[model samples]
Target: MGSLAPDSMVRRVYRCMCGINPGLEAPTASAKTGAFAASGVSREQLVIFLADTLRGTAEERAPLIMAMSQCGTEAAAAVTCEQVAEFLRDLISTVIQIVVHRGRLQGWQPERMGDGSLGVKLLAEQMCSELKPSDQGFCDVSSLEDFIFRVSQISLYLEMLVAEGLNVSLSGRPTPTLLPPCRETPWKELRCLLDLPTIMFLAPQLPDRYSAPWRLVFSTQLHGESFTRMVAGLSKRGPTLLLLKDTKGHVFGGFASHAWEVKPQFQGDSRCFLFSVLPRLRVYTATGYNQHFMYLNQNQQTMPNGLGMGGQHSYFGLWLDNDFGRGHSRARPKCTTYGSPQLSGDEDFTLDSMEVWAVGKPPEPEEGEEGEGKRSILDVDPEVQAMMEMAGKTLHSQGLREPEEEQEQ
Candidate 1:
């Protein structure tokens, strides 16, 4: 970049990570409209900034931090923790700005991370908390390197999501430069209880199916406050996330990795998980202790009705009774399948709202979608189906076995 005297291309390309102050500052150029003041960043400084933000190793990035904290001073042997926090804040702000502008939703509408939700500042604090500081409250350089190493995880996701963003990490790093060729999420507008930061946090946790924007399939606000309506909306949709807000102001739910079925038996598989959003952010995935991952049964006199995830019949990690507007999250030690504590503010929580989002591309709708044939045991329990897929075994018996009478549940 330095060899070219007229770094005009860099100037044009570098604007607002959201698209602002148009360039990396140049020494001779008196433009206040670049990334920095006309005191100007030299080629070395630009290289350092790019290195620290993207592919550079932790050791390589540490000097840039020291330079930043000391503010061009070479006298200080090290920086104070307070200065470290300030430096982290500046970098975090710039990172988020770039991510919000050029990353995930580039051609799609970009949204600033929510202040109320988990975001850059909170992430910075969490990183700082991990540092081992000296009596002077000064973090050692090694500690800073460790912190940078941790930040690299976020960088990986950023690289995977943003067009020009990249990293040297990952056992087999993906080439994120290639644009996802698929059409943008089938939906036009996004409306839901989740904030942008919350969505960003959860998106990467999804298995391999990256690039599939979450599409809202059901919401109590959009549809009606009816459990039957939820069932109808979510029944055949592929992997989905169920979100609920309790009257006590807690938000929680679970991820079901396949179509939900109304059944007398436990369904779904290990990809299923229960999550809490508000009050705290946590996801409890399968412990492999139980195959009872997801259960959604309704209108059964003998068996418990309504939707439940994790735990046994009566005690569920998260449950929404078909009775509607009433639910509970119970765990003694923790929920068996997800290993989660009670999610609602109370053991049993009142329903404030409910929403369901289909996670990947919606499957092409099939003809004769309803009452097409007799129901099989595989239809009643999704775990068996999941197990079969994992074992790489064909369901040859599915076609051979005579279908049983659909159990009235």
Candidate 2:
């Protein structure tokens, strides 16, 4: 019964409505009850609005979704697919804007998350695919109502995006942690492949230990395009998320539950999953069909040399060949390991961009370990190192430091 938030938040909500109808006016009254009465919005409507947006069931949210799709127009008996797509587009844009403005960004560099239009389109198609469409290609009330009774991620997405985006607290139950903190990462530029909504979708699915701050160990933009360099970044880093963008702009990747090791055998647990973000937003988890969870092997003349997750050796659900920029996703009907479809636009995809983030807090320094010692400036960038060496610049620091021990592969 008590829905009175701070005055700033009250105004923010009011502005949201006003954005839809520029002619709407703020009520002269200041109190919640008084304002609702004066503004010509009923008390029951406000209660239902809070219920739907805050914690209502899918059935409770269906009506509001319809109304938002109508956009203040007269009651519609049915809404077209385009209407739902537009509604989703607005919701997604609002979530991104909230992340950019209200920021739990900490120190991670914020940049444009690329065009989100295709993601919205794919999301709409996925949602509508469940409905029994009307003769006129519209979603009637019965369609939406019946679909709501079943489990759906739509409600979850709405809640997480709004709650995390607005930075709202759910009384004493809310966790202070949102995205894992980005403190003390060695990388100067901590920009990444995850849009705020994409992170909101993927983060909660991870294990609890990953709630600690994340580290940016590899990025194709900063690190040279060498599979060896990528492997170097992957080694010793506990539990990592790898995101890649293909030439067609489809973005997808997989989670590694344990630190990566270059062995011929597959490694990782069922907690590992695959996710697609750019052209669609969906996660495909393990099916327990087989133990082919993860595979990574390099410098092998006998075995396939690259990184892979799910399915089988050459026919992987997700694969990145050691050739660096070229790879294939060979899931036909579905990937047996995670039940995921081919994620890339094509089976043979060209890598446009890639990044890796190590989850959990960095290990505490060993006794007398003194300085954690910075990595070489060119450790990730071999081409840059060669260019600097060719320019006749002396790397006096390399000689002065203690020779580093080689890590066990």
Estimate, for each residue in 10-54, the C-alpha lDDT of model 2 and write its tens digit.
333433232222222211111232232246545544444454666
RMSD of each: 11.7, 11.4
Report every candidate's CA lDDT.
0.64, 0.68
Q: Write down the worst ten-residue block by lDDT for model 1.
A: 12-21
Show model 1 residue runs off by greater than 4 Å.
Answer: 1-42, 62-96, 99-139, 143-152, 156-191, 367-409
Give model 2's clash tally.
Answer: 0
lDDT of candidate 1 over 186-251, digit per residue (tens): 333434566544554566667634566566678777677998999998988888889999999888
Best by lDDT: 2
Candidate 2 regions with alpha-carbon error over 4 angstroms: 1-39, 116-178, 183-191, 361-409
- For model 1, the local distance difference test gives 0.64
